[model samples]
Structure formats: C-alpha cells, structure tokens
Target: MWGPSFSLRDRDRMLEGEWHTIRLASSKKEKVEEEGSMRVFMEHMKALEDKSIGFKFHTIANEECVDHYVVADETETGEYSVEYDGHNKFTLFDADPGAYAIFDLTNFKDGKSFNLVALYAREPDVSQEIKNKFEELREKHGIPKENMVDLTQAVGLIPERVLVPTLQIPVATLEKEETPDPPVLSGDFSPGLQHHPFLSTHHPATSSHI
Candidate 1:
C-alpha cells in the first residue's frame, strides 16, 4: 500500500459485503501454522454522516461476539486508522474493487510492534495475478517472500455474505472466559503471531489479533 492506493472508483461494488482472508504475512513470521476453520465477519457500516466507512471485525468462537470498530473516511479517496492501539497505524493501500484488498497494519503495543500485510478476497481464494500483486506490495514493505503464509491453504470454506444480527447482549451481561474473545483488542500484544488473525482477530495491545 503506497501513496494511498484506496480506490473509490466503485465504492459499493468494491468494498461492501463479506471477504475471506486468503493470504497473510508479516515481517516477523518465519513459519506457518496448521490449518483450521476461521470465521471473521467484517461488517461494512455507513454510520458516519460523511462518506466515511466503518469496519467492525467480529467472530463466533464458542458463540461469543464482541464490539469494536474503526472508521475510514473518503469523499473521493481515503485511508484508515485503528482506534484501539494508541501507537498503531492502519492503512488500506491497494484494492481491486470487489475482487480483493491489500492492507498493511503496523501494530504497536507495550512498546512492541510488527508490520503485517493481508490479502482479503471476495471469495475463498485469489488469482495468481492478485497473489503477485500482494507479494509486490509486501516486498515494498521490506517483507520477504518467506514471510508470507497461506492462511486458507487446505482449508475449504466459503461463506456467503449474510445479514448477521447485532450483538444484543451487553458487555456487562456477557460472561467472561479464560481464553480471550476474538478481536476485542484488550489482550496482550506479543511478537511472533501464533494464531491466524482470521481465526482469532486482533487490533492493538492484544497478543494475537490482526
């Protein structure tokens, strides 16, 4: 992502609906993890009066859904920001409209930080051309080819974009558990990501959420 590669050529056709985490890589990842089912729903919102878009990341692990969000504004073009981590930078650099999106997240928490680039696709997989583009962007970020990992490898899953009901259970009412819920951004932030962000989403200050 460079010089603001976010496209507004066709807003709805490109950015709306559900997407899957195809490939994810980081400047620190040296190995790949075993595959499993990972579900994350990126709810695209029009809550702001301006042409800004809100992205809320949530998951259903053991039937627990939390609330957290970040807004990205665009009159004709735009970028993004993370609300959780005070020392983090979120950027949406290049996107192929509805086809795919490439974003880089630099998460800094507890004075530790790592750069990550993710490829989100409308479907479960990406084309070879798109993969090349992803690698190109990561390489530009000083991330080598060895750092990349196919999160969707050998994992066959494709879910349609369906309307999910909002979290009606208040935070206070929801029961707390030992394991951290996905993407709340309230946990520890450590180096060397252990979980695929698609499985356990993270923002900042959290041990593992992307």
Candidate 2:
C-alpha cells in the first residue's frame, strides 16, 4: 500500500493555522453525472467560505462521512497521524493504500506571511515547476502516476476571518439540546471510506458573513 510521506517542514506548514480561504479546483469524475455533482460540491465549499462557516471532518470508523482516519500511533520514522479536520481538511491523502502527495504553498496576504496546503492523489495538471515537484516525490516513492488522481486544480484557498464572541453561551443551556450531525453522502459515497461531508449539497445555509 502506497501512502503519502511528508517532510518535517511540510507537516509543520500544514499544522500552522494561517490559511483562511479554500476552493475546489478539480476532482476525479468518471461520468457526466459525477461531473455535475462535483460542480455542485465546489459551489457548496465556496458558499461556506463566503459565510465564514466551519466544519469538522469526523474520522471515526464506520461512521458516515468518514473519508479519512488518523493513525493514532506514529511509526519510528516520525510519521504523524493521517487525519483531517476543519483545519487540515484540504490536506489530502488516500484513506486507503494509494499514491498521494503532501506539498506546501507559501503566499503573502496583506503583507502577512501565510501558508497553504495542497494534497494530491496523483500529479496535477499544473505548471512545469509544480509538476516537477510532484514527479520528484513520485519517483522517490516509486509510485506510478496512473494510480493517482489530479486534485490540485480542484481546490484552492482564500482569506478567512476569526471571530471571538464577547459573551459565552451558558453550558447548561447548550447541553440541554442535541445538535444534529452533519449531512452524509448518500448516492456515491463508499461504505468504508472516509468522506468530506461538508462538501455535500444538502449543507445548511446561513445569512451570516465573515
């Protein structure tokens, strides 16, 4: 089974909480219906960022929308856990044994330094420079590009806003009610695989803005 290996620098950059916006630039689709569904999925992500909303990626096994899981124990090689959440949701890796890439993007926003993460299943249809980087990693791992998916163009990042509430909601009141779970993918989702449920079209809407 092929898995993505990230350098220490790359891992640190991803764990850093400097990114604000994310976009879906591309995905893997085998049919016209899948393509349509992917478009809707991209639109939903855009809507979430526009509204400054956040989501959690549930990694528990057998749960719906469990697209990825974290290897709780690290190996002697110092490989961190393979997990995804609102913070590292864009960080891509194969939930199963497959080829993947863990890379970094350094950009300046408003004169402040920030980083973006791009995870690819296969080589992306990007510039020669970017392709070269992916190629180097592929060669190092001896993984063929044919087995990977080009998700580079399918996703992107934008600015994000941090909100700090002045007043805290009472814990007693909050605990009195149960919050509904995020929607799960119905038609195309695999039974045992982890999924990004926040990308579902059935996500709730809000009038709030960042």
Candidate 3:
C-alpha cells in the first residue's frame, strides 16, 4: 500500500526545547498493501503521543487537547529471495517516518500555533538520556511507570523508506488520583544526598518530548 516519507528540514534549539520539520518526501510502493508493516509504524507513533500529554495540572484546567501529527505521503520497497526450502520469502520496508512533518497543531492561550521541534538522522546529537535511579524513584514512590523505554526502541525496528502517518492521541480522560507522597523520614539521613545525583533528571517529561 502507498505510504508517506519525510525529509527533515531545519530546526531551532531552545533552552527548554526545539522545533524542526520533515519535508514531504515521496510515496510508498504501488502494488502491495502492507497492512501489518503500516500498522506497526502507526502503533509506534501512538505510543509517543500517549507519553507527551500525560502531565497533570496543579489546579483545574481546560479540556486537554491532542497534538496533531499527520502523514503527508510515503515511499516503500520490497524484495523476495529463494530460501533453502525452495520457497521464496518476500520482505517489505519503508524509509520515511512520515510525509511532511509530524507536529502539534494545538493553539495555545498565548495565541501561538503549536510549534514542533523536528529531529532527523543527520541532526546533531540532540538526544537525551535518563538514569536508572529515576526508575528506582518511580518504583519507590509508588508512581505508575510507563513502558516508554520498550516502546521507543520498538519504533526503530520498523524498516525505513516509508512514511507512516503521524500517530494521533486524544486528550486522555485521566483519572485524577490524589496520590499521597510517601513519608519522608527526617532521621534516615545517609550523610549526603547520595541518590540525588543519579535521580535521572533526563527522563522524558512526556512521550512527545522524546
């Protein structure tokens, strides 16, 4: 099936974030509808959308809106080879992550349209990391953990040269739970804040931010 591909354009870095665009590339192969492959790509993006909007507000807020990431177009390729069993197995693939660019279309109260930071393979090392201690903290504090690590890595397994549509996530109807903080014992001093440095501050604040 036809899909979309994106070419990364320019991006700007901010102290807090960045913005970039993936230029609309070409379309996928014409003869086959690789539904399984396309679905795999879609699921990967949906996972990202989920994490990006997981934050809770301190006070009551307006209805949460979703960020828009769409597929402008896509391109794909495939090949088949004879196996030792005297049968041919065909493998299909795509190169584009999406057509045009994936972006958040929300208009903020400030009247600015949502700006997106585009990341590409050739872009400088714009990636970040988080420490295991953050996971430890999540476990210790009884905070529900997100399986983002597994999800993000899974997206890479999708072959290239195809532009899957940008994944969409609705404003999740979050159950507001007043999670009480665990008791902090003042007397359990360990001389210094040994665990603070390894607190994994680099963890993604939201999935979209990744």
**Predicted model with the maximum lDDT:** 1
Q: Model 2, range 77-181, lDDT digits (tens) per residue?
A: 443222222111222222111223344323333444323333433222334554555555444544444433443343222201111131345799989999999
Candidate 1: regions farther than 4 A off: 1-4, 7-14, 30-48, 58-78, 84-87, 154-210
Judge candidate 1 against the unseen true structure and give its global Cα lDDT, from 0 to 1: 0.55
Question: Which prediction has more favorable lDDT, 1 or 2?
Answer: 1
Q: Candidate 1 lDDT, tens digit per residue, 120-171? A: 8777788899888888878888987777777555332222221123313466
Candidate 2: misplaced stretches above 4 Å? Answer: 1-76, 83-126, 153-210
TM-score of each: 0.53, 0.28, 0.17
Instruction: Name the better of 2 and 3 by TM-score.
Output: 2
Query: Which digits, one per residue and each the tens of the lDDT, describe model 3 over residues 51-151?
Result: 12111111101211222232211112222222111222221112222221122111122332221111121221223322232233234334333311222
Give lDDT for model 3: 0.22
Which 10-residue span in candidate 3 carries the lowest summed lDDT? 7-16
- The TM-score leader among the candidates is 1
Clashes of 1: 7
Residue 171 C-alpha lDDT in model 3:
41
